[model samples]
Target: MPPRSDSDNVGFLVADVTRLLRAEMDRRITAAGLELNPGDARTLSHAARCGSVRQNLLAERIGVEAMTVSSSLDRLEVLGLIERQADSVDRRAKLVHVTQAGEAMLESMQPLAAGLGAEAAKGIAPADWQRFLDTLKHVRANLTAARDQLRKENAAA
Candidate 1:
């Protein structure tokens, strides 16, 4: 088989798409006059999605350093968008929860997100979009399982 070009590589394509999408979303958020910056908006969204989660785990989920997430969380707390409470099982650890105001913020952002999604789906049919999402989910699951297997092997070595 011939070597694949960057345009033909799945990883490259995925990364490019993700980066472009994030950039566009950030631009839209700024244009929409949202008070929160992109990082803080993302932090709030992730915290809301994860419900009550530990700070370290939230950092991991957001793919950012704990300190970076901490800063975002601080800003969010000041905005009354999230609350950090002591963990019941671990007194030293804090669990992050999206406050009512955070939910409201998320709701406000829904129209922005929907508009972006609609724009992205401009050429694709509904069925094709569904299939694409399903395929991506399957690819993600395969990669996650492989990662887990590697971790287990490394632990046992």
Candidate 2:
């Protein structure tokens, strides 16, 4: 095969990094007795940060489909880790808020997760570290823009 393009190489690198990071996070969280599947943990974390996000917005923020978010929320609510409340402004819309139990779990998981992130970035020069962050942000923005464009086109169609 011809030499890979920059985009191809970057795609492979991103996949590799994502897998490694996810594995590490899963190990740490499992060790802490969280027992959360990746999706549940991610949803809970988002709820923790956003206070109470609209169901659709929470799905978008976590990069999952609305149905997936709803299912995850169902499990979380059943486990007493989250609660859904009617949005006063839009009675039709529901908001997801983490329960006290969820907050405590998130707080307990913070130190291990934060330390893992720090260790992962260790030894990089400050300038290079900054650039790495910027590049990742740029990639995410590009993907988000592309996704939005596609959504608009689909709606038009």
Candidate 3:
């Protein structure tokens, strides 16, 4: 297939939306005293979701280095938001788990995320909203595939 023209391509739109969301999230998190960077927030959220995730797997899922994940986990542990425990299955490896504080923080961030979504959807029609969501999912899938392809190419190179 032919490549899309710059204007026709959805990349710019996706990038802009991502940028805006990050900024809004940063603002809200700062206000809420989470004091976390985007990467930290994402890591914490992942830990919260997985209950207990392998360190390497969490890093792979986040598309970051294991070292970065380790550092973030250290900071989170210090903050009493997360803990690392020996993996039950593989006694040699450690798994990440969110503490009660982390759960509370995640819960607190929900309303802020909802408010941001509501604000973005303001004045949009119902049909348009559905289409918007569909387009977003499509974009997400496309980007995920691209990321996986890039990782493969990088490994080969």
Whole-model alpha-carbon lDDT for candidate 2: 0.87
Expressed as tens digits, the lDDT of each residue in 1-157 for candidate 2 is 8975675588788988888987898788777777677678888988888887899999988888999999999999988999999999999999888889988878888998888878888999888988999999998999989999999999999
How many clashing pairs in candidate 2?
A: 0
lDDT of each: 0.93, 0.87, 0.85
Better of 1 and 3 by TM-score: 1
Q: lDDT tens string, model 3, 22-90?
A: 798778777877657666887898888777899999998877899999999988888888989999899
TM-score of each: 0.92, 0.74, 0.74
- Runs of candidate 1 with Cα error greater than 4 angstroms are 1-5
The lowest-lDDT stretch of 10 consecutive residues in candidate 1 is 3-12
Stretches of candidate 3 above 4 Å error?
1-8, 35-38, 138-157
CA RMSD of each candidate after superposition: 2.3, 3.3, 4.6
Worst 10 residues of 3 by lDDT: 3-12
- Report how far off residue 116 is in candidate 3 (Å): 1.2
Candidate 2: list runs displaced more than 4 Å: 1-8, 35-38, 49-51, 56-68, 87-93
* lDDT of predicted model 3: 0.85
